[model samples]
Target: MSTVEACEAAQTCWFSCRAAALGGQTWTDGPLHWIREGAEQNLMFPTRIPADAVQSAVEEARETGVQIIGAWLGTEVDASALAAAGFERGWAPSWMAAPVADVGVSDDPRVELQEESNDYSDEYADYAEMLKLTRVRPQHTWYAAAYVEPGKAASRKLAGPRFAGRAWSHLTGETAGVFDMNVWPRFQRRGIGSGLLRAVVAAAAQAGARDAVLNATTEGRLLYETCGFRQIGAGITWWLHLEA
Candidate 1:
């Protein structure tokens, strides 16, 4: 498979995992994978173009009063197809990938810890609070936080938010997906983001992932490139509003 295909597959796995963790459901119909966490959190990923599944989903959403967000995996799918299906183009994120072996570890003064679990409420809270302090809104529900301390301090008082990110690996697979990597505004340029990224990548590597993939924001693109990740393609999400 092409690199974009591999990355998109890994991302689909990540979305599946997200649905499971958030008490949702996932299923596949033809080349489209559907993930639904709630009425407000329905998403579709099209792995192939000319997918009649998109039109069918739009019809279903119209009847159910639900919103459908379609994520176009790679360049193969034309934008007009989604437009025809009544989806409006939204933000585009860069698809990136790198071999796990090529991703180097960070040696910043702060201690890093990576946690993989179905629930990340505590970490998510810290991540959300950091974003709040920085006047940025938190975008994801799962997160790992990197704090600055003399050592692996056990108390929150002894450490502060340096960096935070989220990642998930497919079961019985070699691909992992990284998401929502962020450095607290006060900690930017301190190498903490690298430390946090390395920790997340290492966790996925330990979980049998040979390659790491992620959708990077324009602002975070340089940081990921510095960590040996290259842009393989780009993905755009289109929204279909059936909710009334």
Candidate 2:
């Protein structure tokens, strides 16, 4: 697949995985459009929509009872169409990817990465706590069994009691997409985040994935870049607040 196509496919898989884990829903309104209803009562346009069809998608998303619309800008997607439709562009993240061969695994002794089982009980609780720390109010149930680094006992209250860093990857054939990576504020810059990231990428590679992709926040762009991921495209989310 072309880099652009890979990037789009990676994002599609990432959003779908999140929706499944969180008890949300996903559907496509045709091949060019993919929508996700996140657990937080937010709508996600994870793929590109034709410029002429943007307004219709927004209208349809409103019927799902979500208060926020998160639309990602793909190649050839017109940003002005979104603005014209009452969405405000925010949090322009970078879509990045790397060949599995380029990712380096870190053997950090201070941190241990654990992949949760399918049950996801422990991982979900840890993720909930992380969301709480960030003040995110999720309205629907969400769960994922992914990579996590158990925190030290003494740091339980500040970091999650069971995890200091969390991340997950979804494999779509030969391509893998990484999602929801975060390090507790108390544990930031201690190398825990990078270690967990490397571990997850390596895990995907072991699962027969040749390429790895992720959408990175501004603060995270450098970290992924240092780990050999290059920017393939832009993932811009336009937020539209619903009227009460």
- Top of the candidates by TM-score: 2
True-structure RMSD, every candidate? 7.6, 7.1
Candidate 2's C-alpha runs over 4 A off are 30-32, 38-53, 109-162
Each prediction's Cα lDDT score?
Answer: 0.62, 0.63
> Deviation in angstroms for 24 in model 2?
2.8
User: In terms of TM-score, how similar is model 1 to the real structure?
Assistant: 0.71
lDDT per residue for candidate 1 within 18-81, as digits (tens), equals 5565566787777667776545434555646464766776676666545555555455566676
**Over 4 Å off, model 1:** 40-55, 62-68, 79-81, 109-111, 114-143, 149-172, 241-244
What tens-digit string does per-residue lDDT give for candidate 2 at 64-121? 6666767666645556767888878788778888987787765765444343333236
Candidate 1 Cα RMSD (Å) = 7.6
lDDT of the structure predicted as candidate 1: 0.62
Q: What's each prediction's clash count?
A: 0, 3
Cα lDDT, model 2, residue 153: 57
